[model samples]
Target: MTLETEFERVSMPLENPFTISRGTQTDAENVIVRVTDEGGMTGVGGAAPSPHYGETAETVEAVLPDLLTAVEEIGDPHALHAIEAELSTVVTDNPAARCAVSIAVHDLAAKRLGVPLHRLWGLDPSAAPATSFTVGLDETERVREKAADAVEAGYSILKLKLGTDRDRELVEAVREAAPDARLRVDANEAWTAREAVRKSEWLAELDVEFVEQPVPAEDPEGLRFAYERSALPIAADESCVTLSDIPAIADRCDIANLKLMKTGGLLEARRMIAAARAHGLEVMCGCMIESNASIAAAAQLAPLLDYADLDGSLLLADDPYDGIPMLDGEIQLGAQAQAGTGARPKSVE
Candidate 1:
């Protein structure tokens, strides 16, 4: 029987300013996709705007209507693969929107099969430990304040967003703010290869665990060069999007940051994780600013990943759905299993 598909937008305001190399954000607007089967089981998914990656509310909104129409025309929720194939043909760009629709389909499919999303992805949900919370770039005092808040809130690991001129100062302030916390840094491809290596020297002094996307996405050679020179482990973010991008980045990066939006959906993300593991790279599950829908989708992959950054929902001032509870800095997998990842808003109907 054919299923029904619908789309809408949810706006989540950030508790504080979220700044990166691309831009700053106070509110996170996400595209929410809902899929309902003939049996009445439903699954939800979210796609968050990554302005740095050229995604925005307007762009996602524009893309979602057509995507939903095409998917609904296909009707059969079980024909997810075929539906995704058809979707690729219609929506040529704005992968984040495609990802949202794809994830919703996967969630609905899992529900229909009477299995959790993680099991469908071939992962043991219990294996995913706590995720890391991010501290965006800010003044030292503000950085410390945020770090302190996260630490006090029960997060043991903190990912400090750096890459600008005051990288060292930010790290130091975070360190002071959360003395015993496990700290790491992400450059988000802001540094040149040379600058990455140079900055690594200073970061090493702060005992930063790893540095993510220190150089631009296209500079695999530079990434390798920086990896060789730095004592800190390098993680590939933008450089490693699809499974195809894995082999090239494997030798250069010690870790890979996987996001649902980048991988398109759980099926592809599972494949990417297996490939990354085969290449002997650790996996880090990350996310853009989103509500429970997006976080829940990524949570399915959390058990298999070495690091977790599913703090997207936690940063929001208000979340429309009760998807997963991120307590302290760790994601409560047990809670996730009980609640399931794809919890939809009651208003989604």
Candidate 2:
């Protein structure tokens, strides 16, 4: 059956000003894609652009019209890889836009089979690991407050944004606020090799799980130097973008942080998980600050992950779609008998 496609740009407001190594954002700029088959089964997807990855809302939106046209030309929602190949030829470098199309196709395939995405992939929902809610860079008091609030809300794990010189104080405050919660930190490529090793030692003392992307993406040698002596496990975020980038940094990191927008789609993401595992690196399925559309698509692959950082939707003040349901920090997907990614578009009322 021929597939019909459409897209819309959405700006999802953040609950708080989200700060990372790159800067801050008060809203998540996203693009939503909807696909409907001749049989009337519908599938949806979303993309959250990050300037760090060289994609913005304008870039994503600029590529969507041609992307939609390409999807219509392809005509078959089940041919995900084929659609992906066609999309690559249609547009280059817009991974977020590519991700939106890839996700919509996967969603349509699962919907056509009358099963949730995890079920279609032969995955177990119960085995899906708990996700970590993020606490962005904020004032020490606000950071402590946010940590306490997350713990009080029943979340067992918290991922904190770190990079500034106040990193030590911020982590210490949160540790004091939520003594029992498992903690992880993302440096967003803010540290130098020496600084990464030094910070990792300090972070390890506080029981931080792992340090993500300490050195900038441009410096592979720096990551290697830090990896040699880092007291905490180092996960590659900025340094690892696509499949090809994996082999280059495989020895430089202990973990691979896979995001749909980074890899361009669910199919490539699945490949990334397998590739990471093949190389003896643990897999972390992560996301940008996004709506439920992208989070839901990523959730379908959670069972394959060693760690999950899929808390993008949790940061949104209001989401345009409902997909994965996260309680505390755990993902609930056992009852998604509906087709697609099980995320339904919400009325903009």
Candidate 3:
């Protein structure tokens, strides 16, 4: 058997400027990857690198050729373990690039079996959590308006970016607009332990479900302090990057937030989930600002997550590829009739 591999860089504008504690993004740059088997069947995936994680489109592009070379060398879609293991040897740090190939290989393997990705893994589609639409950091009024728009668009869960002097005011604005929506907040490591504990009390009063990454990953003790004192549960994103990090954070945070770009691939993501659960931490899956090519792959693991923040594709102004159907904020993995990850060119769909 022979495999053919190719990739392209794509840039798409966001619906609006997306800001977090770290910075803002006006556009999402992704590297799309495709791998084909000898019989002409193809798998699709993408890499949406985050600069915060020390990756960019250029880095993803630079690393993919080597990763894809490894995929083709294996020439077996079912050899995911071998392909990924080899990919790690090729480039250990470029996880997003490895993730793209990981996704493609998984998609291809599922397609060969003629089953949806979640189905292939025996996950119940109904078990998939409804994804939260994020309200990026912005002017108070604008943030309120975005929340209203999300409710109007049928997202029942809303994750708000909170990491500023006016964090309370910003969250209040969103609550005023989305009184009934399930709310979660991400500070993106902007606050000290004392400040996080203080804010968590008021945020709880406003019915926030949790506080995510209030303290930076570098300060593990701060995270533990906040977790011990905060009124609301804390989720660790920046703090929990890999399976190894899970043990360290298990005592510090209530939730373990995993992302494909950070984990490098699907198989490792599941392992992380299990590890988090064994450590008695609730698990959540999040994503970078991305297109459906990658977000769709993340959705496949929705059933395994306690909270789903897979709204990356929803932030895009437009996407060239269509993945799973997400109607009314619920990730409808079974909604797709076609096999694989439900990612294909919009033209093909």
Candidate 4:
């Protein structure tokens, strides 16, 4: 079947200025992708490029022509394996761009089959864990307010971004604000090994569930040092990028954090999850700041994940697209009545 393709960029402001250890973000840029089958069945997807991973909206737009060109050549959305394999060769990097195409193709394929994307993979929707709402770094008081707000909004789990000298103060404030919330912290490669180890102790004291990417990914030995000594379970985000990195990180972290934008496609993401399981690592699926276009695709994998941080779409001040339903932070994947990834454009004013 012949296919058609197109993409466009969108800029959306965050509800709050989102700050992490490395920096703050007032807005996010997403590149949206679409693939249409011969019968005019259209699939939608998006790319939320991360500068930390060496991608931006500009780069994603720059590479889509070639990636979508490969899809046109292949002429079939059902040939998921062949298309994904070809995408890798078409552009060795720009995973976020490739990811957009992958998502759209998968959406179209599942829609064509008259099933949701998760159903296509045979995943049990009820197995999905509640997603964690992120409290980006801020002054201790503002951070506390954010935590309180998240809890008020019915987020049962909270992932607080930490990396300042006031890390303890921040955690304490959040812990005070969200006493019963399942807590996780991500340092974004900001801490030293010793600092991570030390912080992990206190974080555990606050009843935190885990710490993520504490030490710089550039330091494997440091990660090992922290992982061996930390009181809380450690999740490897920056340290784990692909299926190849899974085995290497197996011994260094408790959780293997996977991002679709980082992995490039749904097939590779499944492979990473399997590889992580094989290596005895707990699996988490996180997302970059995004719209429902890509977050919906990520949510389809929630059933396979031990942890879910697919709240990227939730962080936006407003989203042009809506995806899977969420009730008190639990992803309602089965509630997605539409076929494919279950993303649809929100009504415009």
Residue-wise C-alpha lDDT for candidate 2, range 1-349, written one tens digit per residue: 6878888898889988898878889998898999899988878889899888789989998999998898998898888889998888899789999999889888988888888989888999999999998999989999999999999998999999999989999999999999989999998989999999988887999999999999998999999999999998999988889998788888999999999999998888888888888899999988999888889989989899989999999888999788777887888888675677878877776
Off by over 4 Å in 1: 337-340, 346-349
Candidate number of the best lDDT: 4
Give one digit per residue, the lDDT tens place, for model 1 in 1-349: 6677777887778888898866788998887888887777777888887766778878988888888887788987667788777777788777788888888887777777777777666666568878888899887899899999998899999999987778888888898888898888999899999999999898888888899999999888999999999878999999988889999898898998888877766667888989999999999989987888878878877888899888888888878876766767656656654333656664664
- Tens-place lDDT digits, model 3, residues 67-172: 8888877889999889888988999898898999999999999999999999999999989889999999999999999999999999999999988999999999
Q: Is candidate 1 or candidate 2 better by TM-score?
A: 2
Worst lDDT 10-window in candidate 3: 340-349
Which lDDT value does model 3 have at 140? 93
Task: List the candidate numbers ranked by lDDT, top first.
Answer: 4, 3, 2, 1
Q: On lDDT, who's better, 2 or 4?
A: 4
Candidate 4 backbone collisions, by pair: none
TM-score of 1: 0.93
Q: In terms of TM-score, which candidate is stronger, 1 or 4?
A: 4
lDDT of each: 0.82, 0.90, 0.93, 0.95
Which portions of model 3 miss their true places by more than 4 Å?
none
CA shift of 173, model 3, Å: 1.0
| Weakest lDDT window of 10 consecutive positions for candidate 2 | 334-343
Model 4 root-mean-square deviation: 0.7
Task: Give residue 168's error in model 3 in angstroms.
Answer: 0.8
